[model samples]
Target: MTDTTTQKGDQMTDAPLLTDRATRLPAGSPDPAEDRSASTGLSVHGLRKTLGGRDVVAGIDLDVAPGELVSLLGPSGCGKTTTLRMVAGFLTADAGVVTMGDRDVTTLGPERRPSAMVFQNYALWPHMTVAQNVAFPLRTRRVPKAQTAERVRAALELVGLTHHATSKPTAISGGEQQRVALARAVVQEPDVLLLDEPLSNLDAKLRVGVRDEIRRIQQRLGITTVIVTHDQDEALSISDRIAVMHDGRIEQIATPAALYARPATLFVAGFIGSASTVAGRFLTGTPATVGADDTVLVRPEQVTLCEDSPLRATVARVLARGHFAEVVLAADDAELRAYVTGPPPAVGSETGVRLGEVLVYRDGLLAEVVR
Candidate 1:
């Protein structure tokens, strides 16, 4: 299935982003009835959506606390964006409730909900100045000229794009343009913030910088935020918690540490990080609880290489990975990958391998964590 969220230019790769009818910038104005003082926590219950006769988002329940940043992470077509859009009021849920703070906004349009979204494509109008772009949403609401200008100035300053306030979208760097998009969203001061693949367009170096900047700004504002991302590293680095989705349902929701240390299901184990699955009998530790029906997950960090150990393996492949080498070893008919620092053994060399702490799964569910 084609991804409905991710996109490049006008062509979409994932879910389509919401935009103004006349321009590519975001739509919606602040609703007069929205309670600004209400709880900012975001909650969704029994959300469901079907597209092309197939379930795109199947029964998703999520809660994002006020001032918390949670990421909806999964591969494309897994419905992370679909779920986000439903919560954002862009896509209506088949059966569910989307509540922000104390408001039940399931029937409200995007404009009426107290939420703001940052588009993945950074949909700033090419003809508009950065300040104008940031102030566009405020203008939609007929905000006073003085307040709009003040908000625009403050937004640019917050994103550190004050000097580029007068520049057109075509003139600024991609990273700067992305900041402009974020600034536009931040200026709204909405209770809930939604971002659709906010950093998918940036290069590696800029991604880290902007990601940290976003976290800083979100923390400063204390807004409830949800970010949809396919990048595990991006989610792990910024999110207070991550909801790992697969097949239109969330398989697990936990902190970065908990998700990495103990994934709830078989899909989560392979999705959150790298791992090698081996039969329980091949595992060197915890023989009492491990059996033929058990499968052991060996993370790269858990693979130990010591010359004096009794376990044996043949070096298969050594891959350079900048800070460390990913050494693939052939052991007991399974390939175990280890992250080795400094010099690594050559191919075809016999070496000692030992399993450290590992997760044991049975019937595709996390059965035990053998430490």
Candidate 2:
């Protein structure tokens, strides 16, 4: 792929001790004006895409502030990838206007846009050394060898892979390869950086570490970014805001805390965190989206478990979570879960469950919020 294209696969060498350093463009030969791309806001208005006669990406509108990292989060087949492709100019939108800063880029191809991408699969050339792979983009653009060398060294250093600059892609570890792909993308210093499930292939422990590194690098550089992922934890941890997509359109877009505290729809509430549902009425008054008979939902953290209550429930199950235990209680054909610390009640033991700050919903839309 050339500088114009977004990004592709890659791999890296085993890096037992990776260094985390301040990330910025390195000294190089390119003109100072063109080397550092200015941060810019991205806007997509009436974006639509249809695949196989189905509306994969329905009409959608989004605006991302300069240097903000927004995530397109949803389950598989929610059109997140399609929307990303449209934004990257890889897949032409059926209908919509895509603008970066003030320039309308709806008709531009991937090569013409000032953006970079990192794919899930580290697509690296097996024959080329890590340094060479990172330098390929500069080479394609006819950059001077001396400048390319300096830039590649800085890029590798930024990703903590400077020691493996000469190692072949096939010889590196998977995590190392991922860093190499990231180095390649960041070396260009594009205005926008797009990542698609960048950490899905790593182990749980490694995933956490890599995600932290990504967040650090993104913050230090302040490049406007959009990441696509299904992992709730990943999106919540790194994004400035998250856009929850469902059935091709954006369900809700808000900060992590706001999204979790007050979801706009039941789908968002259920999708973001674990919530137990029961038929009940809202003493807080019926909201615009709710009806007379509302469905109340409470998160496990909000549900308290005690050995006292007039209406008792039987402890049905208990799941040990490292720091706390999730206890499932059954009462009158209804089930609720509570997060309990210390010692949880034994199975079949009778206990009382009290809900705090409930969320009311009617017809799958949020009706009321206690807090």
Tens digits of per-residue lDDT, candidate 1, 7-31, equal 2222322211221111122233232
Worst 10 residues of 1 by lDDT: 15-24
Enumerate residue pairs that collide in model 1: 3-13, 3-14, 4-14, 4-15, 5-14, 5-15, 6-14
For candidate 2, lDDT tens digit of each residue in 189-282?
Answer: 6668888888887779878887887787677767789999999999999999999999999999999999998888988887897888876643
- Tell me the deviation in Å of residue 45 in model 2: 1.1
User: What TM-scores do the predictions have?
Assistant: 0.85, 0.84
Model 2: weakest 10-residue lDDT segment is 4-13
